[model samples]
Target: MSKKHRREEDDEHPDESWLLPYSDLMTLLLALFIVLYAASSVNISKLEELSHAFDNAFSSGINILDKNALIKATDEQNKHQQQRHEDVGARPNKEQLKQEEQENLENLKKKLDSYIKQNGLSTQLQTQLNQSQLLITIRDNALFPSGSADVKPDAQKLAVAIGQMLQSYPDYEVIVSGHTDNEPINTQEFASNWELSSKRAINFMKILLQNPAFDPKKFSAIGYGEYRPVDTNNTAEGRAKNRRVEVSILRKYTDTATDDTVLDAIAAQDQKDASTASP
Candidate 1:
């Protein structure tokens, strides 16, 4: 009877097999909470390591936490975004640089114009500041004789003054171009207009380079002969205008069509003025 009573007592208690799964669920929930808390402070790599450890310990191989991967992806995205911001901040803006360059050219032009007007050189020389260059046009009579390539002794002073002014701008490239009228020439020294124009350009450039402040490597001489005339070759006055020398200081920030557009406008204006004065 006692044995029967013990069996009844054992049957009165319930089976506890469900506690095994319940305990496992509770442990997983605790691990998830810990991972979530740590993820708020740590990088993605550490979270991934912790996830692997939890997966190994559980032995069920069931993926209980996908939030770690999500957090890792978010972290990587933020890192890339910050890097892009830094890159953008480090570089200079293109439009700002262009504006600064334009201002610098304008100031230089003002200085040159003031010097020319003060010295009463308006008739013999003129300066034009355009998008691609600063052009200084000089009448041939001011620098050379009627049929010679040699620069006059007194004209050396003009070159010296120009050189002094140019000393302030050491970074520019200066091009000295010689132009002539359509009249052909055959001298003992020069066989053709091309040779005369080229020699004239070279001689004038040499005088400018005499200043110690001028960089010889930055200067060049070219002759367009009668091809690049600013005026007509039909009359004596036009021919006189055509026979000239041009000193071009090339700009550092040049645009593709800006130079041509500005030059064409200036040339058109000059042509209109010349035509108006002709008759």
Candidate 2:
């Protein structure tokens, strides 16, 4: 009776071994579903947190989850890189800037020439464009009286017109330079040609600055006096040519070289003056 009862118990149990694998399969399926759900959101931070948790829980780190997170991060980085490239492509390059600036200066020169010709003031005013700058030269008699540093009332119109024209190029550096003949001057107002020339340059520059369109920081005034002469002061015609004012619109590309040349000329003149005075 005992033996028969034991056999019945064994038959009733009927190999509970299958339950172990079925439970394991259910657990694996649950984990896989959780991983798939996390991946669908594409939140790298959350994925990284989950990966770290899995790494702590298991001896071997969560290699599969880490790989998915890396892929997501790479995709995002690539998207940002592509956007940056497009943005850079939309902006003007250095060569384009140079070309545009050159065009602007050329157009400005043409307008000035047209105005000078139309007003029949070509004899008094002249414009020349070179590699380093666009120079506008005005005879001293056109803007001032004999031995006077003040600008004539009629010349104010010319100054105003020039100031208006310069409004288009606010970025350019403007230099107003005053020059004089080698004739010695000793007046009550001006002690010498140096003071006369300097005052003239400052006064003219102030007139241009009155337009409010010009940047004060970009504008400067200097006096060369009898030095840096374009013509010899031996003849009446040469002296007339030497006594003038120059408005220079310096080029951005050659500004450094232009400045160096001016400095060198001034130094050389100073040395010559010192040598002449020593004797």
Candidate 3:
């Protein structure tokens, strides 16, 4: 009688081994469908994973039952791979940097030219771009008195404007060089042309450095005096041409081969100056 009573209790309980698994499968399917709805456009690999997940969720076969958590782990693994793909482990190469430097110098040249034209200082200011440097030549009379080193108050604006333009390119080496005609000067304030030229360069450089955006180590002042004359000293016109200050923006990158084009431009300019200066 006890055996029969136990049998009756077993029949009432009806083996519920599949119920738990079925409920878990239903939950996974519902979550997967929600994910699918959010990401309607999936790649081929994603579609394959979803299909495999659906097969497992439906209890389709015993073959894939051992790795039931394959889909759950796949998401994390794919995400890790994606992050690695997004990481660009490359930096700009030498040629790329050279190209960028060229473009920047060109742009700065254009800006300077526009500023010169707009300010009606074309006669006193000129720019030359070469493989070696970006040369800006300014007549001494524009920045100083007949024999003075002190910059005229109005000309400080030009210096400041140049300084502001240079702020955009801070890495370059800048040189403020003063030049003068062959005429010898022995004033109370200046003993010789050397003293006058040196002070002029120094004063102009000081004004530029006032912006504080520049690295002082990269800046320098040079005094060429009458040593580097681009024009003849015989005539008044040539002397006027020779007395100038030059702001040379030294180049960081150079071409593999030599470029004599800048020399040609200088020759052409000299011819022009000589023709105009001739009496």
Which pairs, if any, clash in model 3? Answer: none
lDDT score, residue 218, model 1? 98
Residue 233 displacement in candidate 3 (angstroms): 0.6
TM-score, cand. 2 = 0.69
Write down the TM-score of every candidate. Answer: 0.63, 0.69, 0.62
Error of 3 at 31 (Å): 56
Better of 1 and 2 by lDDT: 2
All candidates in order of TM-score, best leading: 2, 1, 3
lDDT of 2 by residue, 206-266 (tens): 9999987788999999998887666656678878988999999988765566678868876
Ranking by lDDT: 3, 2, 1
**Candidate 1: regions farther than 4 A off:** 1-91, 257-279
For model 3, residues 210-237, the per-residue Cα lDDT tens digits are 9989999999999877767778788888
Local distance difference test, each candidate: 0.82, 0.83, 0.84
Q: Give each model's clash number.
A: 0, 0, 0
lDDT of 3: 0.84
Point out where model 3 deviates above 4 Å.
1-89, 259-279
lDDT of 3 at 157: 95
Give the worst 10-residue stretch by lDDT in candidate 3.
61-70
